[model samples]
Target: MSERVVPEDSRQRRRPTKQGAVLSEGLIVETALRLIAQHGADALSVRRLGAALGADPTALYRYFRNTDALLLAVADEMIGRAQEGWTPTGDWRTDLRAMGLRIHACYQSNPRAAALAAHRTTGRPHEKRAVERILGILRSAGFPDALAVRIYHAFVDQALAFAAQDAAALALPAAAQEKEAEVWNAVYGKLSADTHPHIAATFPLLAADMRESGYPFALELMLGAVAALRPERRNS
Candidate 1:
């Protein structure tokens, strides 16, 4: 028979870390997020996490089975924070816009963690609640089950894809970020009109629009499509 593992809470009660600080799963996740924010996602290792927490690296295993498990917890925390104060307005479109923006803002604010976990499915409490909320919004808006699920997939994935893309940009080193930021002026902005007439014609507009994250614009388009597919519209 395999050895039975002890529960995390029981373990936590038994011993504090070497620095005399108590280690809870919440504290560990918080420290990991801080480490990622300061040093980038690549800096997240059990050893580094332990050092930051003043704990034995082995002690971390008592709470999380592995780094992946801790990552899921951290990912779930992102969802939790995003959903913390959110309430659906009576209007489904407005609620969705609010939710999509809230999640994007949360991810943008913690780009290092977002870059690492944006595509993750945590199967944790916060993720479960978010899934429920989105489905609830669609269903309550009169979408049939199949259609609602389909739209949910597109909406959530689009938000995450945009978040990850934006986060990757945010996560770049300072020098790389500056080079990318200068591309509009240094490369596209200087293209000969004869060679790239269309781009030249729109260069002023493109320059202003391209500087921001595309999530909000993409989100509006998505919401418009979803509105078109609403059950009432289809039935009419």
Candidate 2:
């Protein structure tokens, strides 16, 4: 009987070397982040990332214990990007608004990364700094320490959640996204005049505002509500 021989490349696929591993972790993470951003978190896998990196599947374990850990890292990296060059000007409202918008913009830039990081807390340095800065702004605005923390939590959580939802909606395939818009237009455009007089009357303004702005309007509304609840204003 003739002995069977495995292909050289097939054998090489089973093992990876540490040489030139400097770029391996970063490359894997970047590629995974891109894939996740484009395809959603469920689309990522160590094996797939390795294949994308042209390394052994086991090669990724050197940097990430598993996919979850790598995801956390990606989340941290995205937050870090959001916080790059951030500096507070000491005006609590302006500072907080800037911070909120910056973080929101970061998610907007990469919806996939935002979706993955949305509900997952890494407690990474950047995340900690963001929390501290937000809490500081609230406290500076005369919120009680405890209340400031609570408000900060509410603000960040809501902002991130909304960002994630927006990202997911935006990430939909073009056809599906257009279909959603068409459905909205159809439903709103065809509201019966008599049965929905109030809604019908306001439909033009609503549609105009919807076309002009979506999340920014909501973010502004949220900030206005939070500002109205400021302790200094309440005391005055």
Candidate 3:
């Protein structure tokens, strides 16, 4: 029977709204992400998400027990986006470097979401799949199991850590963000050569260079160190 096919407790049921919209878990998660993007991380909640989706606040509970569950879902969705376009070449170092950058870029695209993901682990299928792919890259590079695992752990942690830091900075209110720039210009730009010779020397470059991310620089340093540890390179 149709009833047997679709149980009474089935949470997959969609509810129509006055705005000619229907609510589902996917829609709820998508709207939550949009709200975070538009209004910053503080924008999310059962009520706010419901309003955005044009559904009752209780309707969201059917899909996700609470906000934490919903945030994990959002994070997993972000990981999926990060991993979607990645295709590994045969070169392990190249692939790993690219992978790091890709994840960074993915998190940057949705800063508030990244901030939330910073402290939580989804332990979900998408993240697991990404892990497998990275492990394959390291193992194929002739790294022993133990070393490969260590490198993978460090590499991922570094990328995510930097992404979160960058997202937190970006999540600052517009006035706050501008204040950082103003401080760098007003303070760092005016250091005296007699009192702060080193800073004065670098002041010209600081205006432009400091504005750019240090993630790529740090990532390359880590990757180069890992590459040198490859068995053939070590023995040679």
Which lDDT tens digits does candidate 1 get at residues 86-155?
9888688998998899889899989999998999999999999999999998888889999999999999
Residue-wise C-alpha lDDT for candidate 3, range 170-225, written one tens digit per residue: 88899999998788789988889999999899888878887877899999999889
TM-score of each model, in listed order: 0.92, 0.83, 0.90
Regions of model 3 farther than 4 Å from truth: 1-9, 233-236
Per-prediction backbone clash count: 0, 1, 0
Q: In model 2, which runs have C-alpha deviations exceeding 4 angstroms? A: 1-21, 233-236
Best by lDDT: 1
Better of 1 and 3 by lDDT: 1
Report the error of model 3 at residue 41, Å.
3.6
Q: Which ten residues in a row have the lowest lDDT in candidate 2?
A: 1-10
Worst 10 residues of 3 by lDDT: 1-10
Error of 2 at 154 (Å): 1.3
| Candidate with better TM-score, 1 vs 2 | 1
Error of 1 at 127 (Å): 0.1
- Candidate 1, residue 197: the lDDT equals 97
